[model samples]
Structures are given as C-alpha cells and as structure tokens.
Target: MLSGVSHTLRGLLDDLQAAANLRPGQMVVVGASSSEVQGQRIGTATSLAVGEAIVDTVLAWATELGLTVAFQCCEHLNRALVVSRSTAVARNLEEVSAVPVPGAGGAVAATAYFRLEDACLVRAVQADAGIDIGDTFIGMHLKPVVVPVRGRTRELGAAHVTMARTRPPLIGGARAVYDVETARQRLQGV
Candidate 1:
C-alpha cells in the first residue's frame, strides 16, 4: 500500500512537472480520500495509515523540490485546506481555526495537518497545480486557466486520480496582441 501510494505520487509529480515547470515558492494543493484509496466510498472508511503514507510522501517531495504543499479537507470540513503557516502568510490566505481529525476532517487532511511544519487551516488558495485523489474535488483551489494533464498513473491504491497545472489565462479578443516577445519589447520602451 505504501509503495503504491509513493509510486502514484511520483507519477503525478512527473506529469505536473512536465506540464507546469514548477519553481521555488510555487504551491501544489492535494485533496485525497483514504477511504476511496481503500476501495470504499469516500468518507466511509478513512485510514490513518494510508493517509500518513500519502501525506508524508507529498510533504517530503514538495519540500525537496522547494515548493509549498497544501492538503484539502473533505466536504465534512467544507473543503477547507491545510497549509503551512508560511504558505498562508506568503499567499495572503485567510487562516481559519480548526484541527483536522481522521473522521471529521478526513485522514489525508488530518495526516497532512499533523505532519506539516507549522500547519494552519486556510479558506482557500490559488495553487499552481493540484491532485485530486478519489474524486475529492480540488478544482476550486487552483488558479484560473487550469490545463489538465493526462498522467500515466491514473489510480492510487483503489482510488482514481486527477491532476491539473495552471498557466496564465489568455486574454484579449481578435486584434488584441498577446505575444511574449512583443510584451517584452514594449516593456523595454521599444
């Protein structure tokens, strides 16, 4: 089970990195259902062991890559997110008062909350990328102009996985220019 979770996470990262060029200080939000990972309906059979495996792996990988990681709570908690205090401060996110538990907040969020250094609950975040495991629905936390990435690892344990990475939204109608080189030239007073 542990190995499966780790492999799935690695696969998700590979797909995300391929699509989004993540850099230092970027944020990645994840929403997971341990029950679904165990082949049960979401919120019905949450498992701390599975949650710990996923959370630990995510935190370690994100930290090593110099990225911020956020874990989204289940509908039981109104889909609030668990993030590091530094992340909240840096991103100007509103911090809420709540401690996640296995049953109430869901095991994945609980494990991430307990494992994160200086963890805090936030109402929302515009994450650069996200992973939704077991249909937990993490779309609301992503930045606008989300580009979905079809990854090689589609499932983790017994759960289905979905991944996304965001980019700047394309603006302007016809006759409106949106070229990076042109923008750079304008910025230089060309």
Candidate 2:
C-alpha cells in the first residue's frame, strides 16, 4: 500500500510538471479525501495517519521541485484553501480565521494545516495548476483556462485522480495562427 501511494504521488508530480510546465515557486492546489482513497465515503472514514502519509510523500517531491502546495478544505470552510503564510502573502490572498477539524475540513486539509508553517486559510486563489483526488472538485481554484491532464496512474486507491493545467486565453480569430507545436512543447516543459 505504501509503495502504491508513493508511485501514485510520483506519477502525479511528473504529470503536473509535464502538463502544466509547473516551474519552481509556482503554486499548486490539491483537494483530496483519504477516506475516499481508502474506498470509504468522503468524510466518514477520515484518517489523520493516511492524510499525513500522503502529504509527506507529496510534499517531499514538491519541496525538491521548489513548488508550493495548497490543500483545499472541505465544504465546512466553504472549500477554502490552506497554504503557507508566505504563499498567501505573495499571492495577495485574503486570510480567513479558522482551524480545520476532521469533520469540518476533512483529514487531508487538517493534516496540512497542522504541518504547514504559519498556515492560514484563504477564501480562494487562482492557482497555476490543480489536482483533484476523490472528486473533491478543485476546478474553481484553477486559473481561467484549464487543460485536462491524464497521468499514467488513473486512480490513487479508490480515489479518481484529475489534473488540470491552465493557459492564457487564446485571442484573435481567423487570420491569426497559433503555434500548436510550440504550445505543446511548452506544456511538456521542453
């Protein structure tokens, strides 16, 4: 089980890098449910241990890549995001006052809150990319132009994995010709 989780996290990091061109210092929002990943209902089987393991794995990789991580809270916080205080200040996101409980923010978010340094909850953010685990719905946090990313690992345990990378909106019609190859190359981090 540990091996599987590690493999899934690696695949997710790779996909996010390749598909979103996630460079160093970029922010990525993740919405997850350990219960769903364990084949249980969304909030019914909340497990701090599972959440910590997942966060530890993912954060190790993100740290190596110099990327910032944001964990999305459950509906109890109105799906607000928990991120490092630096990220919130840099992004100019408004901080909200709230401590995440198991039932309130789900295990993953609560674990993130506990682990993060100077952690704070924000109402929203326009992240460069997003990862949705167990159908937690992170689309709203992603930038305006979202492009779907399919990783080698489709599912992480019982959770369905979905990824998205945002791009600038395409302008100019008809006579305007966009460089499709360049765009693809950019996405692949070439």
Clashes of each: 0, 0
Give residue 12's lDDT in candidate 2 (0 to 100): 84
The pairs that clash in candidate 2 are none
TM per model?
Answer: 0.91, 0.90
Write candidate 2's Cα lDDT for 1-190 as tens digits. Answer: 7567767877887888888888898889889898888889888899887788777877887898899988999988999999989999998999999988799998888989988899999999988888888899999899889999988886888888898989988889865547989768777999
Provide the overall lDDT of each model, using Cα atoms, as 2-decimal numbers: 0.89, 0.87
- Among these predicted structures, which one has the highest lDDT? 1
Cα lDDT of candidate 1 equals 0.89
Worst 10-residue lDDT window for candidate 2 reads 174-183
